[model samples]
Target: MLFRQLEYLVALARERHFARAAQSCGVSQPSLSEAIRKLEEDFGVPLIQRGRRFDGLTAEGERVVVWARQILADRDALRGEVDAMRTGLSGRIRIGTVPSAATAVPRLIDPLCTRHPLLTAQVMADLASTDVLAMLREFSIDAALTYLDDDVRAAFRVVPLYREKYVLLTDAAWAPVRGESVSWAEAAALPLCLLTTAMRGRRTMDAFFAEEGAEPVARVETDSFASLIAHVVPGRWAGIVPLAWIHALGVPPGVRAVPMADTSPAPEIGLVACRREPESVTVQALLAAAREVDLRPLELLPRMRMPGPDRTRGSGQVGP
Candidate 1:
């Protein structure tokens, strides 16, 4: 039960390959194997299923891997806590965020770093919401920025950040109608570029469309917001996107962001972390920052107005 042995076991579980696990741990394959063997002897049970190649973990090994991850996480937490007490919070906080929520990461991290100057932040911004939660459970990410729902609330500690409001993004020329806002039915009628079905945001949009009895087919499907913007910028396809995205990445020249008129209560996005007995100091800091940060700027984007008859086409202005 040495910490090194636990490290090797956890690495093996993560990589699922003996060689890769050893490489990750910066140790030789034999060293990693011997450490695990000693750990197995101490436990008096087989932890890894043996084979020429790395087979999956045994049932007991699976259980051990779970414990190993927590133990390692706690070890890191302890070190972080001590360092915080001695100086201030100082460490890397890894955050996994859904694509739509990526724009909000800076709002959370900027203040955290200002308060704890030594603390650094790493963001993995392209993950799906499910993957964000899965990584949180595995102790891979310190926090998650994603849609907050009942299922997420039950499993982890969450700090509600903001609501994600939907908007239609299009080149003014491609806009289905000129208005301060657009209906889901009107949005569905246009050539659209949307996130693939795999994304939660896309699913949410689908539900919105379903409510209106509109089944808008995508002219182009993509996983990334950059790609979504790319398609919409050409004035060929319109995109339904979060208003926060418009705030984060300004509408391109000739593009318009019309608020969704028939949108229901927007989905709540939040900061989520594991609910351990003693939470990670990094997570605690993030939660604090989230609570204090004012996200009203995202909600206050320039109000859209219907273009006047004399207004120039492709001007890209949202308001009069």
Candidate 2:
């Protein structure tokens, strides 16, 4: 079948609407349909379940769609590789990241872009770790910045970036004495705002609480770290966030971040890419960039003295 026909089939599978699929492909509805019909003739199978409106794909169509995605991804990779060999890496690298890694992803992308100025980075943050992996499997993203668990390690090629450490973020009025670390039990006792249960970071935090025999209930739950931070800033609720978050996005005035006293080993976060036979050049470049990232700033976050109430908002400076 022609590549154009495969493109139409994939678009139809994604949009699930004949008109919309044609619109997305920048072709008329009849043209898209004719292409699909021709593709079916070539394959000798019915790809789509026919109806007046758009029906679901046939079992054969479903299988073809999977192959289509892989073929398209490989085709793009070939183009990217040729372009990079002639010029520099000049295409968009779509990245999917969990919200907790918001601060760390930049360390990977910034260097990649600096080295390859023609490359563009598209970051989709606030996804759950599981969702990030799913997107990577579906070829929706070029790479992922997420927790490196056993499943991830087994499934993808992982380049460990940094271990994520937790901290308690709250208004200074509600914070512990300066330089004092907060325990899981102590953090759970506070009126806390946390990520929703859907997020892997929240699940990790919940496990920590379980280990401490503390089942602290959240006063507020949200999927967005920004929303959780907003709740903590009000002085009525505290939040558990990655220490790297404070280093990346400093707290506003009147807010303080206390290191978590838990001795449990932190979870490792990493750059994950599919283990295809011929990986995309952009993905390879990203892996190289990830290896060269300076994680010392994050490593020092726990030992550094966090700013006190007197410190200026968003200064991200260590106190003496």
Specify the highest-lDDT model's number: 1
Model 1: per-residue Cα lDDT over 1-320, one tens digit each: 48999999999999999999999999999999999999999999999899889889999999998998889999999999999999989989999999988998998888999999999999998998888998999998889998899999999899988788777887766535687788888899999999999999999999889889999999899998888987888888888887788777767788877888756777889889999878878889899999999776665455433367654433465632
TM-score of each: 0.93, 0.91
Question: Which regions in candidate 1 have their CA more than 4 angstroms from the true location?
Answer: 303-315
How does candidate 2 score on lDDT? 0.85
- In order, candidate lDDTs are 0.86, 0.85
Clash statistics: count for each candidate: 0, 0
Query: Where does candidate 2 stray beyond 4 Å?
Result: 175-179, 302-320
Q: Poorest 10 consecutive residues of model 2 by lDDT? A: 311-320
TM-score of 1: 0.93
lDDT of 2 by residue, 1-320 (tens): 48899999999998999999999999999999999999999999999999898888999999998998899999999999999999989999999998888778888888999999999999999888878988888788999989898999999999998888877887776535355677898888888899999888999999999999999899899998878888887678889888788777766567777778866788988889999988899999999998888775674443333458544434322222
Tell me model 1's lDDT, rounded to 2 decimals: 0.86
